[model samples]
Target: MELKRTNVPFLLSLALVVLLALLPVTKTWAVGIALLLGAAVSNTVPSAAPSGLGKMRKLALNTAVVLFGFGLNIGQVISVGGQGFWQTAVSLGVIISLGYFLLRFFRLDGDTMKLITFGTSICGGSAIAAVSSVMKARDEEIGVAMGVVFLLNTVALFAFPLLAGAVSLSPEQYGIWCALSIHDTSSVVGAAAFLGDTSLSTATIMKLTRTLWITPIVFVLSLRQGEKGKLSVPLFIVLFLLASAAASVLPFPVLFKSLASAGKVFMAAALYMVGFGLHRSVVKKAGAGGMLFGGILWSVSIVVGYVLASLS
Candidate 1:
C-alpha cells in the first residue's frame, strides 16, 4: 500500500487568510487577530501542489486585483492632485532599504528576505506571488513571506481606520494614507470601508498608482536573479490595464460594477486554495527566526507608511 499526504494544515492556513481578508475590523485590535490567524494557518503542505493549482492561485490573485478596480471611481483616481505622491515614493524606498539591511544584519538568507520584504512593503500577497514565480523562489520562502504579510495586512486594515477617525483626515488625505500604508488591496479596501464608500473610492486610485510599480520591480529583481528569459510581463497585467480603462470610459455604471465583482470572486478562490493546501508541519518548521524577520520587514513598512501619509 502507498501512503499519501493530504496537506490538511496548509489548507487550514489558506482558510484563515481568506477569513481575515473578508472581515472588516475597526477599533477591535484587528492586527492582533490577523497575527493570531496568520500564525494559526499556513505551512501545512509537505510540498507544493500540482502545477495546475499553482496556475489557479496565480489567476485568483490577478482577478482580485482587477475586481479591486470596481471598488473605486475613474475620475477621482485621476484627480488625487499630487499630494503625498513623493512621500509615498520616498517612504517606500526607505522601508525597502531599511528592511533589507536589517534582514542581512540578522543573517537571514538574502533571496527569501528580499522576497518577503518586497511583498510586505509594496502590495501584499499578490506581489509576493508574482515575484516568486518570476524569480523561481522556493515555495517555503514564498509561504513564510506571505504568512507574515497576511498578519500585518489584517493589522493595517483594522488599525488604520481607527487612526483615520482619530486624526480626522479628509478623503484625499485618508485615501493616500490607505494607499501608501496597507500591503494588500484587500487590506486597503477593508480599512477604507471603515471610513465610508468614498474613502474606498479615492484610495483605490492612490493604490493603482503604487500597483503599477510591480512590473518594473519584477523586471529588476529578475535581472539580479539571473532568472531573466524572454521577459515578457504577464498577460493578466495587460488585461488588468484594459479592465481599468474600460472602467474609466464606460458610461454605464453596471458594467464597471460587475467587472469589479468578478475580480473579488477570483481572489476569494485564490484565498481558498492557499488555505486548503497549507500543512501544519511546514508552519512549525518555519521557526521563529523567519517570522521574526518578516515582522521587522512589516514594521519598517508601517513606519514608512506613516511618514508618507504625513507628507501627503
Candidate 2:
C-alpha cells in the first residue's frame, strides 16, 4: 500500500539520514535528522502507542538539548562570562523587539506574530519550541514561525561566512558575530568554522550566552500570560535547564562524546520536523501578503544584527 503524505515525510527522514550518514554531515547535522523524524512521527505514528515510535521524538528533542553542550564546552562558556552574558541580553532584546515591531507593521494579527517575534528574537528553533509549550500556541502559529526562521537560517548559513571573509574580520569578531546572529547552534558552528578553531570557540561562547537567555525569555513570556491568573514556571523550561546542568556535570570521555553525538542526531531530526510540518493549505489562508510581511521582519532583523555587530 502507498503511504500517505504524512508517512512520506517519515520515509524521507529515514532515507535522508541513511544517505547523509555517509557524507561529512553526520555528527552535528544528525540533530536535523532527528528533528525530521520527530516531526514525521508526530504526524504519522498510529495511536497504538505500543507499536508507535512517537516516544522517540520527545527523547530525541531532550537528548539533543542536553548533548548540545558537548558542542560547547562548559569551560569556554564560563570564561567569556560577564561580557558574553550582557551582550547576549542586549542582542536578544534588540532582535525580539525588532521582530515584534516589524510583525506589527505587517499588520499580522494574533498569536502568529507573537511566536514569530519570539522565535526570531531568541534562539530560532529552540525559541519556537519553548515558547510554543509555554504559551500553548496553536500548531498553525508554530508552523508559520518555523517557516520564517528556516528560510532565514539558510540565508544566514551562507551569508555570514561570506560577509566575514569579505570584511576580513578577526576570529574573535567573526565568532561573536556568528554566535549572536545565527539562528541556532548548528548554524553558528558552520559560520564560526568558516573562520577557524579560534572563531569556533569564540562563536560557541557567544552562542552559549544566547542559550542562557532561554530561561529568562520563557519566564518573561510566562509572566506576560499574566501568570498570576494561572501561569507559572513551565516544567519543560525547568527540564531544559536541568538537562543543561546535568550535561555540565556528567563525566567520562567516550560516553559523553557519544551522548553529545546522539544529541546532534536529535537536533537534526527536530529541524527536519520543522520542514516537514509545512501545511500549505493553512498558511495559504494567511495569504501572500502574510508571507511577504514575515520576510520583511527577517530582512529588517538581519540588518539590525549586522549594524549592531559593526557598532560593537
Candidate 3:
C-alpha cells in the first residue's frame, strides 16, 4: 500500500521509537528523551495530522499489550491483577470523596467539578470524555478537564521514575504505585517502561484492570445525572489475556520472546504518540482553577499510592 503524505510524521515517529528501544543506552532514558522530543514538536505539527495518528497510536498500543502478555503466564497476570483490585477500588473511593468536599469548599462550577472528579478518579481524559457526554458538559469544561489531566500526565511521566528511585522501590512496587496514581494508561505504561520490563508488564496489567472500572463509574454517573452514558470496554485487555493464555499453553519460547520484544518497541511508539498530543493551547484552556483542582487530586493520589505500595 502506498503511504499518504500525512502518514510520514507518524511513520517517522514509529521508527524513532523502535530505534531508541534498540539502542545500547538505558532503555528508560531513551524512552524519556523520545517522549520529550514528541511533545516539543507536537505544537508545530498540523492538528489534522494527529487525528489519524491517534487511531494508529491506539492500534499500536493494543497490539503491544497483547504481545507483551506473552512474557507472563495467565496465572501471574491474574494474581497481580487481584492484588491491585483493592488498590484501584480504594483509590477511586478516596478521589471521589476528596473531590466532592474539595469542590464544595472551593465552590467550583458543577460541570467542571464533575469533569475533574471523573478525570481524576477514572482513566483521565477517557473518563472525562465519557462522563462529559452523559452530563452534557460544555466544550469549555471538557477542554479544561482534559487539559488538566494531560498536564498531570506529563508531570507523572517525568517525576515517577525519579521518585521510584529515591524510594528504592522494587519493580512490582513501582508498577502497583503507577497503576494507582498515574492519570492515564499511557502515562502509567510510559513511567513504568523506564523501570524495567517486569515493571512494564506489571503496570500494564494493573492499569488495564483499573480501566475496567470505567463501566461501573459511568453507569453510576448516568443514573445520578438522569442521562444516558456509554461504557467503553478496553478490548485490548481481553486480547492481552488471550495472549497470556497462549504463552502459557503453547510451547514456543523463541516466538514468544520475539513477540515480547516487538511489543516493547510498539509500546515506546505509542508513548511517543501520547507525548505528541500534549500542547500548550490545551494547557492554556485548562485555566488556573481547573489546574489547581487536578493538581491537588493528583498529588493526593500519588501519596496514597506510595503509602499503599510501601505497606504492601
Predicted structure with the largest lDDT when compared to the true one = 3
**What does candidate 3's lDDT look like per residue over 105-136, in tens digits?**
66568788778887887788778887787788
Q: What tens-digit string does per-residue lDDT give for candidate 1 at 1-312?
A: 122354445445555555554455422233234334433443433342433555666567667766666555445545552543565577568767877678647665676777777876678777888788877788877777776666566567668877886775676667777888788765675566456556755666667666666777888877777875434555654565566667777687787776675554455446445443334554564457767887776666666665566655
* Per-residue C-alpha lDDT of model 2 across residues 1-312, encoded as one tens digit per residue: 345555654665565764553356464344344444544454455321222343444454455555655544555556754567777777777766766666545666557777766666667777788888878888877877667666566567667767875774678777877777777665675556567557765765567567767777777777888774333343433454454455567766566566655554454554554434433443555456555755665665566556555665
How far off is model 3, as Cα RMSD? 2.4
Per-candidate TM-score against the hidden true structure: 0.68, 0.65, 0.91
lDDT of 2: 0.60
Number of clashes found in candidate 3: 0
lDDT of each: 0.62, 0.60, 0.81
Off by over 4 Å in 3: 1-10, 47-50, 227-232
The regions of model 1 sitting more than 4 angstroms off are 1-61, 64-73, 81-85, 133-136, 226-250, 254-286
RMSD of each: 6.0, 5.9, 2.4
Query: For model 2, how many clashes?
Result: 21
True lDDT of residue 301, candidate 1: 64
